[model samples]
Structures are given as C-alpha cells and as structure tokens.
Target: MATYEDSKSPEGPSSYPISHTISASDESNTNMPSWDSDDDPKNPYNWPTSRKWALTCLAAFATFLTMMNGTMATVAHFEISEVFNISETSFPHSYWIVTTWALGGACSALFILPLAEDFGTRPVFLSTYLVFLCFLVPQAVAQNYATLVVTRFFAGGCAAILANTAAGVAGNVWSTEWSRSVPVSLYILGYMAGSSMGPVMGAAIFQSLGWRWIGYMQLIWFAALFPVYYFFFHETRGSAILTQQGKSKDKGNDSVGSEKTATTSTSSLRNLTASATRPMILFCTEPVLFVSTLWSAFTIGTLFLFTQSVEQVFMEIYDWSVTQTGFVQCAIVIGECIGWSLNFLSRKLYLTSTSRNTEVPGAPIPEARLYMAVFGGVFGISGGMFTYAWTSYPHIPWIAPAISLTMVGAGSVLVVSGVTDYVVDAYSHYAGSAMGAVATGENIFSAFLPLATFSMYNNLGLNWASTMLAFISLVLSLVPTLMFVWGKEVRARSTFMNEMTEDGSKRSDDMV
Candidate 1:
C-alpha cells in the first residue's frame, strides 16, 4: 500500500512524485504550471548529476568564447584607432566593436529565442553557433575597416542564441532550488576569464604575435568547445522536450510542435512564417515583457558605455602602458565576478531559509532578486560612477578611482543576474521573448553609445562625463525596482505576461 500525507506541510516529496504530495502554498497556487512534467522521472531534470554538470561546463565554455569575441578589441582599441586612421577628434570607431555585436544579438534574439517552442533547443543551438563561427574567419583577415565591422555585427547576431537563451537552459535543467548557482558560477567565471583574457592575452600577443592573431585565438577556443556542445548539451526545455518524450511513452500522436508541423505539412511554409513572427508580435504587443526588456537593455547599454569610455580615462590621464592599462581594466571583470559570487550566496541563503521555515512558505517574488539590483544601481552605476568621475584627474593617484571601478563592475553583475533571474521567474514562458524585446534596445544603446562617447568626453571633460552617465544609470535603475516590487500586478494587467502566469499557456512555443 502507498502512503500519502493528509496534513499539508511546506515541504513535500523529495523524490520523483512532487505532484503526489504538493503543499497548497501560495495564493497564486491557482496559476501554477502542471507539476506533472516537473515530476516526470524521465525528464532531463532527473538526469544523472554527471550529465547535468557536463552540460553546464559546455555552456560555460561556449559562453566564454562568445564573450571574448564581444570584448576582444577593448585593450587593442588604441592600436585599432591608429590603424583605421580615424581622426584625433573622434575615436568613436571603437564603439562598433561592442555596439554592432550587441545590435546583432538583439536582432536575432527577437526571433531565435521564441523558436525554442517550435524547434527545440538542441537543433537551434547547434545550427546557430556553428554557423556563426564562419563570420569570424573574414573578420580576422579583413582588408578594410567596413568589412570587419559588418561581419562582427553578423557574428553578434548568431551569438544571440548562446547569450540570451543560456540562462533559461540553466533554469530548466535542474530541480534543486539553488541549482542555478552552479551554472551562474560557471558562466560568470567564463565571462571574467574572457573579458580579462582580451587584454592580458592581447598584450602578450602584441608583444610576440600580431593583433590579428587575437581573432585566431578565438578560433582555437571555438575548436575546443564545439565538440563539447555537440556531445553534451541536451534539450532541457520542460514542455517541448518532455512532451516529445511523452509521445514516445504514449504510443499515440507526435509531440506538440511536431504534431502542428506534421498536420500543417502542406502549409509548412505558412506555419514557419507564423512561428517566426511570434517573437516580433510578442515584442510590440506585450507590457510586462517590454518593461523587463527595457531594464535589460538599459543595463546592457550602460555596461558597454563604461567599457568604451573607461579605456581612454586610464590611458590618457594616467599614462599607463597597454599591459598596465589592462590590469586596471581587471577591476571590471573583478567587480562582475564579485557580483556573481554575492548572487550565488544570496541564492544559497534563500534555500537555507526555505529549509528552516517548514510550516510557513513564501512565493518566490521577483524582487527577491531586486536587493542585488539595488546594489548594482546604487554602488555599481551611481556610486562607482561618481567615484571614478570625480577623481579621474591626473593629479590623484590612479588607484583611488580604480578601486571604485570595482563597485560598478560588481553592481553590474547584480543588475544582470538579478534582472535575468527575476524576468525568467516572473514570465517563465516568455522569458526569451521578453529578453529579445529588451535586448533589441540594449544592443541599440550599446552600439550607438560608442558613436558619441568620444564627443561627450571631449565636450564635457572626464569628471562631468562620468557624472552624467552615473546619473543616467541611477535614474534607470528604478526600472528594475518598480518591476520587482509591483511586477505581479503589472503581469496581471498585461496580455503578454498572461501567457506565462496562466497554467494553460502553451509551453512548446519557446525557442531553445
């Protein structure tokens, strides 16, 4: 005879049958997604630990390589400026390195992320990442400036799959509450390694090899990570993957997206068109998603804006050599690493609290992540900016503002991790679509900001320019705060968020 609990407790089954003994916890219990898929023994969530960690490492590696491509030019910006014969009055050409890639990722995420619903993660991911690598070949060997810029933008477009959707993969792959920490650590570690690698690695290469080899270095990383992706990364989306596996078990119809495609075989063309346009429709129509995207985009824009502008401040004012300049640049990556570490700790704390309070439970508010958002806003952007801005003068020791640099970098970590975690939690279904919407703005701001950074610094001077951008970041940080506090109400009012909040919304619609 099987046993069941008549009395409810906050914590339920620790094993396969999560549905068998679920506690009636939060008021939004009416809107919870089916615990059925979540409890499926055959689900990827139930995969062996070795397999899951393998996949996590693969994502970490791939993410590292892609990010390196994103920031490879930062340390080399001075050399790149001279090579292009750009005017002394404007070194805005440097912005193209970051902005174009951001724009590309934004444009592609708009459509690609939503495709997980129809196509599945593995198919879309392998296809996009492999194809994106081709553009780098031309970029490394480009004869003129225009060609490199255009190809970089196209490469960034392909990166949308890797960067935007990786988090969702992390969320979907595990069952433990703080399982997110493992992936977050791996991802952040890869990110810091990549960003820091650009300068330290670049300095070494410039000393012995050529700057063009920096692009080739990415190719080496590509070769190493590609096989890992092919063999290890499995489809982890709860709805699409599980539904298909369920079909194999049922001996009935094909999976959801499969069934739709098969039935509409004669009109496959029409089906594909409709599916492709879904994210674009989501972008224009949704409110909760749009707001989330706005916050994500602004955060992205500010990060790149700091990247482009900071190099000049260090080089011109402090008179640091390329290698020393790169060390100073370490503060950004250090800050991000610190931010991720705190987030990891915060997740662990939440888990501990949940474990202790057995009778009473709480809904996982998106704002649970917002405390870090506040830190990122106040310290990372505003305070860090002020510290760096007010003291950027040549007279003061360089290390003073340099120490403050870590705050912004660290704060940025919170901003990114918090918004990412919150939006995915709040709008689980359309997290990708919402991300796409916001990324579109983010990449645009990132790309466009560099175009004017030189002029702004020229006219405003270092102190005022840093102050101005700091103030802008302070104002925009409120966006996330409002969402965290009132996001539930906002989601209730919007049709877009309705899809994620309601139980019946189609799960197979998300892109991998």
Candidate 2:
C-alpha cells in the first residue's frame, strides 16, 4: 500500500506515494527502482562531492561555449562586412549580426524549455548541441549577408538550450538553496567569461587567420566537447527518473504503478505546457517578477550596448588596432571577477544570517537576495557609466574609463544573479519557467538594444550618450532597492510563490 507522511522534515513534504513494505519482499519488488531513501545512491543529491563537481564543470563548459559563440562574431563584424561589400556607413546594421543570435535564443527558449520539462534535460542537452553543429557548417561557408545572418539565427536558437537549461541542471543535481550557490555561481562565471573572452578570441583569430576561421574554430570546439558531454551526463530530473522507475516495474504485479505512471506523465506534460506559457502570465501579474525582469533586461541591454560601442570608442579615440581594442574589453572580465567575489561574500552573509535560526529551512528572505543587487545596481553601474562617460577624451588616460567597465560588469552580475536566485527560491519546482521568463526579457533586450549604440554615440556624442545611459541605469537601480524594501509584501500575494512555499518548505512562514 502507498503511504503518506506529514511532518515538518528537512526533505520537505512527502507528496510522493511510497510503498513502505517493498523493502521486506525482495522478489516481488525486485524490479522497483525508485530512490531507496532520501539518501539513495541513485539520487544526484547523495552523489559524492567529486561527482557533483563533474556535472558542474560539464554544464559550465557548455555555458561558456554558447555565450562565447554569441559574441565571437562581434570583433569579426568589420571583416565580414568588408567581404560582403558593405560600407562603414552601414555598420549599425551589422549589429543585427550579433543581435539575431540572442533574438533566436529568446524565441527558441519559449518552446525548448517546456519540452525540456517534459522529456528530460538530458535529451534537450544532447539534441541542441547537434543543432549547433549543423548551423556552424552553413555559417562557415556562407558567401553573402543573408546566408550568414540566417545561419547565425538558427545556430543561436539551437544553442539557447545551454543558457536556458544549465541552471536547471544545477537545480536538479543540488536540491538545497545553499548547496546550489557555488555551482550556480561557477556556471555564471563561465557564462560571463565567455562573453568577455569572445571578442578577444575573435579579434586575434580574424586579424591573424581571417574571419572564416572564427566559424571553423567554433566547429572544432563543439566537436571536441560533444563526446565529453554525452559520456559524463546522467538523468537528474526527479520526475523523469520516477517515470523510468514506473516503466521498469514488472507487468503483472505493477498494475497500480502503471496507472500512476500514466497519471505522472500526463501531469508532467501539463506542467511543461504550463511552464511555457506561465512566464507570460507572471510577467504581467507578479510584481516582483516584473521588477526583477525589467532590471535584469535593462542591465543586459546596457552590457550589449557597451559591447558594440567599446571597440569603437577605443579604436577611434586611442587609435588602437582591432586586436588591442579586443584586449581592452578585459575591463569587463575584471569587473566580473569582482562581482563573483561579491557574490561569494553575499552567500556567506546569507548563510550566516540565516544560521541563527536553523529551525526554518528553504531559501532565506527574498529581500536578502536583493541587498547586494540594490547596492550594485545603484552605485557600481551608475558610477562606472558616469566615470566612463566624461573621461573618454584623447588626452585622458584610457585606464580611467576602463576602470569603469569593471564596475559595470560587477553591478550587472550582482543584479542578475541576485534576482535569479530570488526567483529560483520563490518558484522552486517551476524555477525553470521563472528563469525562462527572465531570460526571455534579458535576451530580447540583448538582441535589439545594440542596434542603436552607434547612432546614439554618433548623434549625441560620446559624453552625453553614455551620460544618458548612466542616467537610465541610475533610475532602474531603484528597482532592486524597492524590492529589497518591500519584496515580502510583493511575494506574499504571488500564487506561484505561495504554492511553492506552502508545499511544506520552511520558507513559507519565515515572514522575511
């Protein structure tokens, strides 16, 4: 008989039915393959520390490749434009070359994430990499603007799975909020490093070997990584693992299990579909989500804006070569390192503050996640933008403005990571969809915003144009501050947050 338990346990609610007697009868239950206990060897949660790190490294590697591909073409834009017979006068249009990748990711994640929820992260992970390879071949040999743009678009759509689902993989393997921080932070580090490194790598390759080698290099790397991915990865999604266990049961004696299997599959499908569409609803209805999405999207938009404008600024004012300009982009990387450090410190603060009351569990107060973000968004980004804005003259030391890039990078990650962790806690099982909602907005901004970078810089002039951006960043910084102050009130009314909380997690009554 199936059993139910309802006590406040560290594992949360015992929602799943368990056959308590199965362990006593070896033969009759021999085929059953569900987790033996919360500490079962098959559960990713109970895996050795070495094993967990392996999964983290694999996911981070994939994230790096995806993000690297997105921006590698940025530094090669001039060469690609020259070959297509396009003029510097039309350079702004070339932003589409970069934008389309993010646009494709934004569009594809809507469907891909849902399917991942249904089938399992393992299938989506493998299939999308194949899609990446397929598009790289066309992009490598493309002779015209249309071919290159179309190929990059599809390649980006395929690669969306990596950015959208890697965190979900981390979520699957590490069940607790605190346990997830380091791995998730590492994944974000790889992702940001890829974005920072893309231009540098592309610039070196294009200057030495020409633009086509960019695609060739990407293909070679993907080919090398695919095998590592296929071999090391295992199924970590709990629902999917349970479904497999149901299928493995003996036919005659497992009638009840079969019926339960059908019900679980159907329910999973419904949840998948719901997750696909739920972001739209939450975007409109959930105040916290709305604010967090807007802040992150704007931060990403500014980052892309810098990506397009930074090379031009250094090249035009400092008269740096393309390769040198790419090196200058390291400002953002330094900033990201600092941001990661701040994230580490923030995690320590969160753990220490909450440890005072180990009686409760789940994520700490949602607002606690926003404290660093509020400060980061308000000061780090605004300070960097203003400093960079006015300091960009031929006489001023380039290091002055470059230092500002570090601040921008730090602020962006703090805001992005903080808001993301907040949403992940708030929406737990549906974290995939919650994160998808955020990525949808973030990528949409990334896709379209850079197109105006040159126009703004040229028409408004450098100081004022960047000043304008700084003003906007300063204004939006209020979002996280507001969230930090009133986040609980905002979360209290959220149906999704409440459901996840009341599902027997200690976070529900913490009243933070």
Candidate 3:
C-alpha cells in the first residue's frame, strides 16, 4: 500500500507521493488545507496513541478476514470439485477455484487503490466490503461451477481493498519511520495468520457442515463486520481528510482551491490514468523495484502453492485426513510468529543505524532493512524447502516436514515485511507506485503458481518438484545481500530517483 499526497509541485503536473512530511513552514504559503497546527486534533498523526492503535488493529483484523477468505477454500477443494463434477485428473482448471480469488484481487487492486485515493479510505472500505459480502452470498448458493468461479472473482475483487489499503492506513497513522514498523508488522502478522489458519478452520467447517458452509461462514463474518466498519472506521488518508475539512470550512474560498481546480474531468482522467499506469511503469523501469518485487512475489507464490502441496504430501505419505492435514498447517503460523519476533531486532538495528548516520541526521540507511530478508531468504525459505523436500517419506517422522514448514513461514514473514519496509523507505516519495508494483506481482504469482502445483508434483514427483522450487528460492535469496552491497549505487543510477530529487529541489526553491 502507498500513502498519497494531494499537493502538486509548482513546476510540473500533480503527482501523488507516498509520504509527505513537509513542515508547516514549508507549506505556509501554499493554497492547500493542512493541519491547523502540529497538535491539531483533526490530524490522524496527532491522535491519541490508544486511538491510533485501535484503528491499526481494526485495519489488521480486516486484512486477516480478507486473507482467510482467500485460502479457506483450499481444504474444501475436494468437496467443491466433487460438487461441481470437476474431474479429479484436471491439471489446473479445477484449481482455478482457488486461483481466481487472487487473480481477482490482482486485477481489481489497480482501480481500487486509485478509488480509495480519490474518495477516501472509509467510504471505499465500507462500500467495497458491502459488495464483497453480497458476492459471498452467491458463492454459497451457486448453481454451477461457472457461477461459483465468477462470484469468487468479484468477491475477491471487492476484498482486495482490505488487504492492500491497510498498509496505507498504517502509513497515515504512523508518520515517523521508526514507529511505523510496529503497525506494519501487525498488519503482516494478521495477513500471515489468516492465510495459515484458513485451511485449518475451513477443514473443521467442511467436516461439520460441508463445503458450502465455507462460503456461508465468510458471509456471516463479513456481514457482521460491515456495521462495525460503517460506524467506527474513520477516514485516515491525510489528504482526503484535509479536503473534507476545506469543504466544510468554506468550499468557495478555502485552501483546497488548487485541488478543486484539478477536479476538472480532464484532470481527473489524467490522474486516474497515471495512478493506474505508474506502478507498471516503475516495475518495468526500476531495477531495484523489479528485483525486490520479483523476490517478494516468488516467496508469496510459494506460500500459496504450499496450500495444495502440503495437503497432498501429508495425505498421501502419512495417510492424514483433511482435518489432520489442515491442523498441520499451523506449523507455518508458528514460523510466522517467530519471524515476527525477529523483526524487533531488525527495528533496533534500523534505529541504531539511523542514529549513527550523523552526516544526514534523519536519513536512515534503507539497506539496514534488508538484514532480516537475507536471513529469511537463506535460512528460512531455502533451508525449509530443502528440509521439507527431503524428509517427506512414509518411514520418516511427519514432524520433520512440519518443522520445515515452520521455517518457511518464518522466512516468508521476514522477507515480505523487510522488502516492504525497505521499499517504503527507499522510495518514500513514490512509495505508492513501488508498493503497488510489488503488490501486483505478489498477487499475480500467488494466483498463478498453484496452478502448476498438481502438474509439477505429478510429472516430476514430490521431492524433485519441491527441490526445483527450493533451488529457485535459494538463488533469489541473494537479492537482499546484493541490495545491501550495491543498493545505493543502484538508486543513484535510477531514473526515478533522479527525477524525484529534482522534483524535491524544485519544490524547495519554489517554497523559498
């Protein structure tokens, strides 16, 4: 997720930067509404700590729910296949039931993020969630496979807002770099927990109430949450809030005149077009972003692939039931918890590095954020994958593979969260586009990777298929270390970075 600013540079067209921390003095002459003072109650950044945390937790919970919904169908895949008369031998088509959800999210997110930026997070959250709930009903009552797949796509689209926007909300509430990691980590924890626990909980539901109940449970949960969000969820996007304040005070002669002028249909279309295209532009043009997002995507894709592969390996080798296989998925959850605990150390290291950088008082080294990512990629992901691959035998104890899963989970958290933090810091001005690129890649990979699961396991055998994936991960694991070594040079040569610096210098001159 990316935070956005409404302020435009005097020398160029309006652009949405990821974070804007300009002091009041810097903006005093600008015709835009800002917080009345640093202590203004209306500023989300100045809200009571307890209140900020409350919203953070709520946003995290929403992420948990949406992610859980994404994978809960995994445990019920067999039942759904049977219900829809899908052939057991169908290579990947049957798996589309799970894949479409992520595909929908990926496809819709480009538009959804822009919509949130235009209107406000609160209304977008509420409206999309309501639509998400409505789509869930059809999933519960689908007449055929097409109906189920179609409805899942739309439901997933609506749900994308929750998963992607929570980070933006986190950025809105936590203005400082040092304090921002806590909420972002919480958000990642919620995402991982929901993803890991979904199949386990869904297995229980499927056994007790059948597969349709999976959809029913989602509907019930989402329906219950709608009212709570409607009543309590406040707009946290700083620019959106300021826009509202301007309108409320005096629409005709307010500080929002510049924003109003940019609202013409031509300008609106241009902004929307830029919002939709800029992420892809950055993803393709920036080497740092390309490599970072690719690494994150592979890690996330492998996680989703495990949903199917884990069930297959355990059920066949150990003769575990669906419910039992589901329970074992908790190993990943355990690993994620350990990875999250390790993040505190990373945070401490980040603070220490920032304090030591006296040459640039407040500019922390972004490479400091990659320490855990390197550890995660090398030990957590690659080692776990190898261990799991070589240990899955009928004679071997099941605990071996389970423990490996724990390693993979922990590694996943470390890598994903670390990359996110690094990108946000490295491209703070355009964090929105950078993060958007990463999110899109993640969804694309997650959506398509599992489609190869059955075919790969069948053609190459379980051990070899797993080994191939592990090798790919192992090779990619070096990304963090390479970034740590040469990231500054890479940034220096980056076209985007140079443009941003030029823009910032131009803005400073204009303010002066």
Candidate 4:
C-alpha cells in the first residue's frame, strides 16, 4: 500500500506555496511519483509564458462563446413568438427562451463545478461542451416551443462549466496576484463583452439569415472550436494531476487499497456533495459574503434585464428598427472595454495601499479592491440610470440614452470585478466556496429579474421603472463603500475568515 502525505487540503496548495510530497510503503521502500521540483515541467505554473497565455486565451474565448449563447437569442424573441403563435401579452413567456438559459446555468453550476474539481478541468470541460453541442442541434431544428426551451436549458447547463472554470484555468498557470489579474480580467472581459455583443450579432444575422441561423451560427462556431479545445487544452488542476501520478505509480498492484484509487466513484461522490453544499453553507453563514453577492447579483441581473428592456426602450421611444436597436448594444461593449482598462487603476491603488500598510508587509488589504466598485456604483450605475431614465424620449436624441448605457456597462464591470477580487483576497483558500456563493446569487438574479421587464416598463413607464432600478442600485452601491470602510472589522468577525486564518497559520507552522 502507498500512503501520500501533504499539509495542504485535498483541493491542493495555495498558489504561493512550495510544492511538497512524501511517500511510504508498507512492504517496500519505493519513491511515489510527484513533481520533481517547483520548476517541474508537469506543473502548469511552470509552463512557458507563451504557452500559458495561449491556453488562457483559449479558455477566455471559450467563455465568450458560452456567455454569448445565453443572449444571442434575445433579438429573435419576436420571431420565436410569431413562430410559436405567442401573443404580445405573452411576452414574459417568450422571454423564457432567454431566461431559462440563465436559469439552467445557475442550477447546473452547483453540480458541474463540483464535478470539475473532483475530476480534472480538461475532461469535464470537453465532456460538458460535447453535451452542450448535442443540445444545440435541437434548438436549430425544433418544431415546438417545448423542444427549444428544453434543449436550451440543457445546453446552458453544460455551458456553465466554461464560464465558471475559465478563470480557474488562468489561475492555474499564473500564480502571482498581479500577473494572474491580467488573465482573470481578460476572462471577465470576455464574459461582459460576449453578453453585450450577442444581441448585436444576432440582429445582423437575423436581418439577413433569420432566427434559425442564430442557432446555426452558434453550432458552427462551437463545433469548430471543439477540435481546438480537444487538441490544446490540458489539465490544470494540481490535485487532479497528483492523483493521476499516484494511480500510475500504483497501477496493477493488488495490495493498493480501494480508498487509494483516485477514480473511485465513492470518493468522487463525497467530494461532489461537499462541494455542492459548502457554497450554500458559507452563503448562509457569512454576512459580508451575502451582502457583497447580493450587490453583485443585482448588477449582473440588470445587465441581463437590458437584453429585453434595451430593445423595448429603443424600439418604442426611438422608433428604431430591430437592427438599429441591436447596434445600440455596442455602447455597452465600449463601456465594458473602458471598465476593463480601469482595473489597472484599481490594481495600482491596491498596491499603493498595500505598500503603506506596515502592519503586514506583503498581506493584501481586501478593502482596497472596493474603490472601483465605489466609483462604478455611484457614477457608473446610479448616475447612468438616472441619466438614461430622464433622457429616454423621442424628443431627446437617442444618443443620450445610448451613451448612458456606457456608464451602466462600465459601472457593472467595476462592481462585479471589485467584489470578486475582494472575496478572493478575504477568503484566501476558501475563495472558491465564497465565489460559488456569489455565482449562485448572480445567476439566480440573472435568471429571474428579466421576467419583470415588460411589466415594469409598461406599468411604471420608462422613467419610473428605470428610476426605480437606479434607486435600488444606489442603495446597493453603498455596500462597497461600507465594506471599504469596515472590511477589516467585518472580516475579523467572520467565522469562515477566522477558520481560513487558523488553517493558513497551521500550514505555515507545518512548513517551518
């Protein structure tokens, strides 16, 4: 029998830690396989710079495609409604075509992400992507609404893996905080950009090729990339790699315990269950996490809500055609790009604050991450919403409301990014569970918030409806500032944070 020992949790070591491994055998002295050194080629963190970036870009592009699929169907809602004999009064039902995609993503992530952690990212990614593509075929040729909705649900479930795991892939290769931020930001850009561009692309395609081609184009693009993913994407999870090494070393040895088998279904199930539950547990128990996630979720939810509201606002107030309305989404894309660039400024502020804090020389001050969110919430989201609401009139140039979207987009990106960075820094190794909590809230908001689009616009009118959301956002926007002011005190009070600190101390002591 082979026994493996390491101080790190089964999820693997922290990004900064030195690699450690030890082996012992009951019947003989044999060296178990492990990374040869910190510079081992088998370790993703040691991969060449070019190779690391290539894979990161590949993962980012994949995330873009999956996110785009969620909203590319937005422009075609009218056509889909017509084809299915759905009435204008049934707008909410037709909206489900888009909503279910997000709903599926939300529900499926709890299970899919856990599976990726237990297995390896490469296998789970390839397998889910294959399943996603299979489901896409039905959407292209579906004869009934049921087929379309059902297939999209399953497809979105599969697509969730890419959006959630792409950043993890980037983190696998770049272990440093600042360097890792670049690729992580790239992935975040891909996500926001994809959502913004989907309607634009869908409109052009719908104008020339019609609604069916939207599905066809997705099929073609996803299929073409399948080969790229299969050929180039490699496993990045460290624990999964180590487990494989252990299995290869012990293969064909009957004395090896069943519990030691890396692929044992029983252990995998336990991991999956634990992974699925921990996020919710943390979410329920952690006040700071709950507030931050709720704020971030509202911003994300607003982004999705725009898929419907933007079209309606422009078509009604600007008298713009569907194609013209689709182009308006470009403003959001431009804003997202600007927001991406602004992250560098946030990083600079973070570094400056860290340098000034002599209490812990190299420790991150998580509150510094909230600066962007403060600017974004106050100026970007709230200010933009107020501007967009009042300027939305046929008498007012469409450009006014359109430009306001830039603020909304920029603000949304900043808030989401700031909150994510703070969670990662504050929670440390438990960041995954903290993030899982955030993702769940964000997805749920993305899924359900849009259901009220038409009702809100029609009942409250554009001015009040927009103002209502803006006010809500204004209130939520205060969260980041509050966190920035009291984050240290808040974190000190957290049970999860204390546990993380204690565990980290134990690991350091073990190393000493």
Q: Work out the TM-score per prediction.
A: 0.78, 0.87, 0.89, 0.90
> Taking the tens digit of each residue's C-alpha lDDT, what string does model 4 give over 1-512?
00011222232322110011110110121222457677677777777899989988998888788888888888888889889887778457877777778778877766566556546678878888888889889878989888888888877777777766665666566655556678878888888788788888989989999999999988998899889899999887666687688877778886784645543565556655666777799898988888888998899889888888898899998788877888789899899889989988987787667455433445445577788887898899999999989999999999999999999999988888888777765665466667777887887888889999889999999999999999999998886677656665776788777544333333223322
Worst 10 residues of 1 by lDDT: 13-22
Candidate 4: pairs in clash: none
Cα-lDDT of candidate 4: 0.74
- The digit string of per-residue lDDT tens for model 3 on 1-512 reads 11222222211111111122221112232545667776677777777899888888898898888888888878877777888888867575666766788888877775655556656667777878878888889778887999888878887777677665654566677655445667778888887777787887888888899888988988887888778887878878776777677677865675556556555345557656776788899898988888888999998888888888998899989999987888899899899999999989877776566555432444445577788788898899999999999998999999999999999999999898888767755665566667778877888898899888988988888798889988888888885687666766776788666443333322222211
Top TM-score model: 4
Tens-place lDDT digits, model 1, residues 1-512: 00111111111111000001111121112322333544455566676778777776776666666766776666666666678765555456655766777678766655445444344557777887777778778766877677778898888877656654453455455544445456655565564445444565665665566667777777777767778778777776544454465455556554755764565353434534543564467667766556655665665566566565766788789877765666566777777777767876656443333333222233233345566676677778689989989888889999888777788777776776666555544544444444444556666776776667778888999889889978877876766677645656776777655443442112211201
Better of 2 and 4 by TM-score: 4
Which portions of model 2 show Cα errors greater than 4 Å? Answer: 1-33, 88-91, 250-269, 352-363, 428-430, 498-512
Query: Model 1 TM-score?
Result: 0.78
RMSD of 4: 5.7
Ranking 1 against 2 by lDDT, winner: 2
Give lDDT tens digits, candidate 2, residues 247-319. Answer: 6654566777667667656765665566567779878887777877888888877777777889778888999
Candidate 4: segments with Cα more than 4 A from true spot: 1-33, 257-259, 262-266, 358-361, 499-512
Quantify all predictions' global Cα lDDT against the true fold.
0.59, 0.69, 0.73, 0.74
TM-score, cand. 2: 0.87
